[model samples]
Target chain A: MPKKSSSTKNLRSALRIDPEDGVVDLADYSPRKITTGPDSRKASLAALEDLGAELVDLQTRLYADGVAGEQRSVLLVLQGMDTSGKSGVIDHVVGLVGPEGTHIRAFKKPTEEERAHDFLWRIKRELPGPGMIGVFDRSHYEDVLVTVVHDQIDDAERLRRYRTINEFEAGLVAAGTTVIKCFLNISYDEQRERLLARLDDETKNWKFNVDDITERRMWPEYQKAYAEALAATSTEVAPWYAIPSDRKWYRNWAVGVLLRDTLRDLDPRYPKTDLDIPQLKRRLAPPN
Target chain B: MPKKSSSTKNLRSALRIDPEDGVVDLADYSPRKITTGPDSRKASLAALEDLGAELVDLQTRLYADGVAGEQRSVLLVLQGMDTSGKSGVIDHVVGLVGPEGTHIRAFKKPTEEERAHDFLWRIKRELPGPGMIGVFDRSHYEDVLVTVVHDQIDDAERLRRYRTINEFEAGLVAAGTTVIKCFLNISYDEQRERLLARLDDETKNWKFNVDDITERRMWPEYQKAYAEALAATSTEVAPWYAIPSDRKWYRNWAVGVLLRDTLRDLDPRYPKTDLDIPQLKRRLAPPN
Candidate 1:
């Protein structure tokens, strides 16, 4: 068995929220925590670039391995409040790999048809096939997170959804998917600044939502809901990492590091071909 | 009614294919046709940059208009053979706009469930919502083009699909979608070079499909299918443009110009607010 890399070990210790640790308090995790050394912003950016290149290689190997009949994949689930920079991470970190190997699905308000089925129905359909990197910008967690915040579902139903999510993730794990869920932890003040920036910029005005302000008004309630959801669902099979996302560069860099280390832990290999190499080479030689 | 811009007029005259003209022969079209002036590659690239910025503004207006209750949207349908730079056009032309307002859907081989539905079922589900710029990397056109080439469906069924596509597109237009379809036209020789390049680059080997070579063997058949599909589906509501795509820079420029003109024609306006401006302003006023 291969051992986890030191970088992976460091990231796990720094970010992972183990369920056994009792109820999680959102206030305990600093949104601006910098795990790297002082004056390390430039180094973090450079390291992110390096990890991005390595991710491209690892993703290709994962894709090739899948093509060669390996039933493995990686699903990166991003959950966060508005202006938490989920799209930024997607554009900078996940976008490094070729689009062919990356499957991005942003779940919007469920249509009547989608709402007719179980919450996991549409999600299961969109899961990355073998050898693909699936990024869910907002995922089934919304079933619990938003629904709970809006009082759309009762506490009993929310708890049931949690159990369902755990089972669904366990099934994915058994089927060879390494699920990495990241909750972009941004502070109330940081979110206010970001939302204000969106309103002020003409180009970004389309992204500003009155609903976001309404949601922000209920910040404490949301934080409580998130804490409960994370504690109830974070499991040994699929863990949640509370990423300090107040700094855009740090958020992007940290996600890249986590993904890079996770891929390294998987250590996907290029499959060997079954064809007779000498015979194929002889067939392809110049006719003369 | 607003008159079409001179650039739009020039592009249409240069690139639009009239179905009434009868039977599009691929041999008659030059993949290297430079519609702009000679030695204008630099100017074209510069113009593309300018148009890209304008597109960002236009797309925002379109999105804002939709948010303000206008039901308008744009759908860019890109259809082409392998190595024809469909993804390149998407990345360079459409990617300039922020992802928040852009919805990209790349269609692959249909699954067992998707196949069970009518051909257009899955296509309809992925259509861009109001206030969005939707890109279909490869769309319903595949039903007619690929199925016809491989004899997956009968000739009668193929004709029915053509009619179905026309009806589908007409519905989209009636409902306020400005549909622009582009066929990236590249030559046999150009495709061969591209495929060879992909094989030569170790980084791109995963993108090298053995099926692409097999499909190349049937290039003539595929070309015939495309020509038939283009002629049959090109209509007043949703016109088809046979873009000369052997030159990547020119191809990107031409598509950008077409989209910029289409948005200019639509001329979506930013919505007017109904809020009490004085009260809101006072509430948000900075503290002394």
Candidate 2:
């Protein structure tokens, strides 16, 4: 096992929710905490840029190592409320990696075909191959989060889904996937500000949805639902980190730190070649 | 019908194949031809940058128009030989358009489930929604090209596919989709150079496939197959443009120009809202 870095240890202690005892209240987490030492936004952003560059190298190695027979992958699951910076995190943080090894799937409302199968069927189809970094903009967690909030599934069904999710994630981990799940925890006040900004800016008007306001009305119920789901689903194999996301710079930085640390821990190495290098070199040399 | 611009007219007249005649010989077209006037590669790339900016605006309007009720879209079908730069076109040209309005589907070899359905069934599932710019990295054209080259389908099946493709494109056209098909034409020598470069570069080694070399040996067969397929499927509603793609700058610019002109022809407008402006203004005003 690799020795844990001070930064990774700090982040895990600060951000990771230990649900062994019970589910924690949303009121316990602040939506604007900047774990990085920088007090100013500019300093935090600068730090994120550094982390982004380091992440690119790590991801490239991870991809190359996977291609070389390591057969390992990473899945980053992002879940949050509307305008809570899920897309923003993808664009600013995850976008740092090259497309060659990065696969992103943004799940919309299920189609007739998707709904026809078990909920996890579509999710399984899009899993990243060996040496890939797969990102789910919203994931299987949606089944529990949305279904429970809307009362589409009764308590019995909801409990079953939590067990199913745990088993599914455990399978992924066994199959050599390191899973990282994050909840972009944004305050209601921050979300209102974002929605208003979208409505106010003509360029951003395309992103504004009237339905988001309707969801905002059910904030308390959704919060309770998320708390229960995260508590039940968070496991040793796939832990959940509630990211304070009111500050865009801090959120991006924190996620970047998490990924950089995770990749460092993985420490994927280049594959050892079995080729006869001397013979190949002689064969490739130009004829005299 | 929208009036065609001088640029669009020039491109259509110069690059479009007259499929009504017969299958055209690949030797008849020069792969190095730069349709855009500038002799310098830098000037060509500079021109592409300008076109890229305009494309962003046009795509935004196209997406907004789709959302507003126009129910129109554009599908860009790119087919080419290996190392002919299909991915390059997507990155440099298509990448200019925002993800919000752009949908890209890179079709790989068919899965068991996909093969069970008619070839067109999978294509239909991935069609861009109204107001989106959908790109098929390798599309249904693959069915005719690869299958015919390998004799995977009998002559009778091949004939049926041609008819199916033409009819399918016609249906898409009737449904308000403006189809632009581009066959990136590259010479055999250019591909050899690209393959050699991939072999030499450590980073690009991942892209160098032994099977690509095997495929290279069957180039003549593949060329003949593409010629026949293009001739059979090229229609007035969906014409095929054989782009001279040896010059990367010229290829990128030509594609950008094609899209810019196509979007200009479309002239997608922002949807007119049904809201009463005066009443909404009064309602939104600060309470006195």
TM-score quality measure for candidate 1: 0.85
Could you tell me every candidate's TM-score relative to the true structure? Answer: 0.85, 0.86
Ten residues in a row with the worst lDDT in model 2 chain A? A1-10
Best by TM-score: 2
Runs in model 2 lying further than 4 Å from the true structure: A1-13, A37-70, A98-100, A268-288, B1-9, B50-53, B98-100, B274-288
Kindly list the per-residue Cα lDDT of model 2 for residues A205-267, writing each as its tens digit.
Answer: 666555666687788999999989988987888988878899888788788878878888899
The local distance difference test score of model 2 is: 0.79
> Which window of 10 residues has the lowest lDDT sum in candidate 2 chain B?
B1-10
lDDT of each model, Cα atoms only?
A: 0.81, 0.79
Worst 10 residues of 1 chain B by lDDT: B1-10
